[model samples]
Target: MSTAQATTTHDEIVATVTGIVAQELGVPAESLAPDADLRSVEGADSVKVLRMIAKVEREYDVELEDEQVFAVNSIDGVATVVLDTLAQDAA
Candidate 1:
C-alpha cells in the first residue's frame, strides 16, 4: 500500500532511461535523443541493450514483458512500457 511508485512521471522515466542507455552504451547521455534508436547508436549491441533493459527494470522495480522489451527501440518506447507497467500495477 505504498504510493511511492506513483510519483514518477513519463518525462522522468524517459530521462532515467536515457541515462541507463547511455551508461550501458558507454556514451554521453546528452548525445542521446528521446526518439533515437539506441541500437543504431555507435557501440551498441544486443548485450548492451539487454543490460539497459535490465537496469531500467531494476530502476522502476517492474518486470517488463519480453515481447514489449524486444519491441522497444528507443527511450520513448521504453518509457512508454515502464509507464504502462506502472499504471497496470496501480490499477
Candidate 2:
C-alpha cells in the first residue's frame, strides 16, 4: 500500500466502514451513525454483516479474525479493529 493508504486516519476508516455497511445493508451512508449498533439496524443480519466485513477487508487489504468481526457491533468498533490490524502490519 502507498503511504496515503497506509496512513489512513481513524475517522477515515470509520467512514469507509460505514459506507461498506450501508452498501451491504442497502441503506444510505448518511443514515448510519458511527456508534449505532449494526446488528440492530433494520434489514441487518449475520450474512449482511459478514458481507460488510468482507468488503471492508478488501478495501483495507487486511484479514480480520472472525471473533473480531462478530465482536464489532458498530462502525467505530470496526474502524478500531481495522486500525489496530493496520498498525500491527506497520510494526
Worst 10 residues of 1 by lDDT: 1-10
All candidates' TM-scores? 0.94, 0.94
- Per-residue lDDT of model 1, residues 1-91, tens digit only: 1466687889999999998988888889999999998889999999889989999988889999999999989999999999999999888
RMSD of 2: 0.9
- Model 1 Cα RMSD, 1 decimal: 1.2
Given candidate 1, what's the lDDT at residue 36? 98
Per-residue accuracy of model 2 over 1-91 as CA lDDT, tens digit each: 6696688999999989988888788899999999999999889998888888899999989999988888879999999999999989888
What stretches of model 2 exceed 4 Å from their correct place?
none
How high a TM-score does candidate 2 get? 0.94
Instruction: Output the lDDT of residue 85, model 1.
Output: 96
Which parts of model 1 have CA positions greater than 4 angstroms off? none
